[model samples]
Every structure is written in structure tokens, then in C-alpha cells.
Target: MNWLNKLERKFGRFAIHNLTMYLIGGYVIGYGIYYLMPNLLNWLTLEPGMILHGQVWRIVSWVLIPPSGNILTIIIMMMLYYSLGNALERTWGAFRYNVYIFSGILFTVIGAFILYFITGGFIGLGIFFSTYYINMSIFLAFAASYPDMELLLYFILPIKIKWMALVYAVMILYTMVRGNIAVRVAIVASLLNFVIFFFSSRNMKPYSPKERARKTKFKQQSRPHMTYPGGARHRCAVCGRTELDDPTLEFRFCSKCNGNYEYCQDHLFTHQHVK
Candidate 1:
């Protein structure tokens, strides 16, 4: 993590702010091309054979090939991942988040080249590589960051994110087991960031549950409650309590809520939705 800190000090200026917008924009462009001139996507895929044949743009253009889905599915996926990516960026900071995402993309590219050479350059795996599993890694990272956070299952029954993370992990495992070599490589390479970033974090051992609890308790007691000039920085939509009322309270905006409504930890899961 210190290495990440050092890298951040050196290259943090180039980190993209709100990177999810560009990612979704790429998808929108891909979808537009898919509907209009479908043949053009062939030139944009990550085909190592094409790259070797001097179509070097394929190396970067492949990212514009959006995940396979209908319009509605694409819209929902974009919106959901946009929120998740932003949350992760906020949680981990832009530099580290950029590293996580770009590393996934880099690994995917490397894996494609390895697979191409392994198969003696006979098969082109352009269709195999996409941002689908990389996006899944983002979802996994969000779940890990807010494990206790709850989401509505189909806009009704509330479920904790940790459970969904578990389900997603199983689903990925199943896909890998049943998929071809190309699919296997794509999935593994895209998700390697999770193993490297999340595990290598300080949360692995020194910040065990008990240790984290102790630190949290110490900070809460020592921190002073401050008042804002206009209004409170954080106010729960349910209880309406601010940091001025209790500096200890952790406030978070509920992603499932219709509007920009926030809640304190006490009411985050139990409060009724606006819609």
C-alpha cells in the first residue's frame, strides 16, 4: 500500500475524475455502432492477429466494444456500475481506483496476447475480451467496501451486499468452470486486481474486526463535534440528526433511494424508501 502511496504522490495528477462517465460513454458509442454499422466493430476488437498484421489500433479500440446486451439491460448496467464505480473511487481515492481498473485492462490485454501465442496464432480471440468482467471486479470491490450496506432485491426485499458478493463470486466460478479457455483467461485476468488490491490492503490483518472497532471507538470519543454555518454537513433523512448532534455517527447515502437522500448508520437499512 505504501508503494501505492508513493505512486500516488508521483502520478496522481493524471488520475481521471468520474472515470465511470467515460466508460459508459464508450459503451454508448459501441452500442451506437452496433445498431448502425455493425461491421465496424470487427476492426475495434482486441484481436492480436490483427495487431500483428499492423492493425495496432485494435489494442485500444477493443475497450469500446461494449458488453453484449439489449438497450434496457445496457442502460441499467451502465447506471448501476456508474454509481458503484463512483463509490469505489471515493472510498479508495482516484489514484488507487485508477490503478485497480487500468491494471485489470492491462492484464486482460496481456492475457489475450499470451493466449494468442499459446494457440500458435491460429485463433483470434477478439470476441472474448470485453469490459464485462472488469466491471464485475468493480462490483466486487464495492461489495467488499460496504459489506453491511443493503440493497433492494428487485426494488423490494432488502439484502446485504456481502451475500450478493458471495453469489457473484459463485457465479464467476461457475462461468470459469463451464467456459472455454479464452473465457477463462479473460475472467481471471480481469479480476486479478481484486486479489492484489483488496488483499494487500491493511485490512488484511492489523485491522482485524476487534482492532478496527477499538480504533473507531478511540477516534469517536476523541473527535470534536463541529457545527456548520449554513447547515449540517450530514443529516439523516429519517432521524434528521447531523454530525453536530453526534460526530460518532457514520452517515451514508442509500444508493437504492430515488433521490439524493442520506441516512445515519442507525436508520440506513430500516428507513422507508422515498419512492
Candidate 2:
């Protein structure tokens, strides 16, 4: 996480925010393929009717497989994932984004483990990643922000991203109904994180009052200070008031005049200012 600080200083908020989400997601997928796949495959394969002997790694590897793969498909998916994920990170900030992602992963992992114990082994759990529900949290965030944003389907017909998201959700339900019980449970498990993290989080203030004040102060400090059109002034020309007198007050450009001015209570109406 030290690199997170470096990234924050170097590339600013959006860069580290985005990199954080992608790193978490990419690590889960990469680790699954590198370590879990071999261990799980000894028990089962892609073909139907394959048997799994409750390999522990299978519980985790199931999250890594993408629903589909092709250069075009992957490009489209990656673009959508990045766009939604970054949008969420920007809207919710770094801590919330991390919570959303890790919470979903944790919920799915836990549900899988429970199912493993109940069934005495990993079985019929292919539906977790088979549908896009695992990634729905990102899409849900995007839909909340730009529900009316239009997207082309099959690159031919136009449709709103929100409506498409709704349709995708329905498709998930349909697939779950038509799929195995384990698959259905896994899909629910994947989405349960959304309910637990975001729904309940509506009432959960992640920041303390002190932290809120600190963030507000930091934002004000980081923002570019306003100045006059001509030259910087230490005191208000109209009222003879110095900036040091009221440090919190900000001076801005005057809409009615050519130069900058700050008005104390005595000459407050004498100038028009823009923040």
C-alpha cells in the first residue's frame, strides 16, 4: 500500500483510485489461474458431468473465470469494467471502493465454503461467474450515475445503459432458475455482498466527524486560490481589510469591475464577486 501513497502524490486521486480496483480484481483472477486451476482440475473440467472431489482451491478459482473470452469480447468487457469501476471509485472514494470489491469477493468465498460443507464437496457451482452478477456492483454504481446514458447493442441498435442493465439482471434470474441449485446459490452469494455492503452502508457512515472536517479542510486547502484580474492584493482596496485579518475569507474576480476586490461588512454590496 506504500505504492498507493506514491501514486496519490504522482498521478493524483483518479489514478490510484482506479489502479486500486483493477489491482484487487486482477489479483483474484491471476491467483486463481496460477495456483487454483491445476489443483481444482484434477477433480473436474469444463465438460458437463465432471466430478469435483471437494478440492479447496475450487472454492476460490470459480471467481476468476470470465463469462466469455475473445479479443473483441475482452476489449469490450475491459472497457466497460474500467469505465464503471473508475466512475464508482471517483464517486465513492478509495476506501468505499475497496470495501465494495473485497466485500463482494469475501461474500462469494464464504458462501462457497458454506456450500462446500453442506454438499460435502464443491459441486454444481459453475453459475457464480457464469453470469455477470459478480460484477453487478460496478454496473449498479454506473446505472445510478448515468441511467440514461445510451449504448449500442451488438453495435447496431441503441439502448440506454440502465435498461440494458435491467435486462442483464433479468437474464441472470432466468439463468439461475434454469441452472443447478449450487449455481443459483452461488449467484445469490455473489450478489449478497451488494446487499450487505452497500444497502446496509446507507446507514453506515464510514467517516468520523473529525475525518469529515479534515477532508473538507484538505479540499479547501488544495483548491486553487482566487485572485484579482490585474495583480495579487494583500488587503481589500475598498475596506482596507487584510487577508490575514480573516484568513478563511476568499477573494475572487469582480464581475462588474476589471480588478479583484474583497468586501468587508461595510462595503459588501460595493462589488460583485465570483467564487
Best by TM-score: 1
Per lDDT, the best of the predicted structures is 1
lDDT of 2 at 202: 50
The candidate 2 region of ten consecutive residues with least summed lDDT is 42-51
Error of 1 at 209 (Å): 14
- For model 1, residues 26-100, the per-residue Cα lDDT tens digits are 988988899899999989999988888999998888889988777787778898999999887766667778899
lDDT of 2 by residue, 149-228 (tens): 88788989999988987887798789889987677767787788566654554543334334556787876764444443
- Looking at candidate 1, the ten consecutive residues that score lowest on lDDT are 222-231
Candidate 1 residues lying further than 4 Å off, grouped into runs, are: 202-275
Question: Candidate 2: where are CA atoms >4 Å away?
Answer: 1-16, 20-64, 122-132, 201-275
RMSD of each: 12.9, 9.8
lDDT of 1 at 268: 96
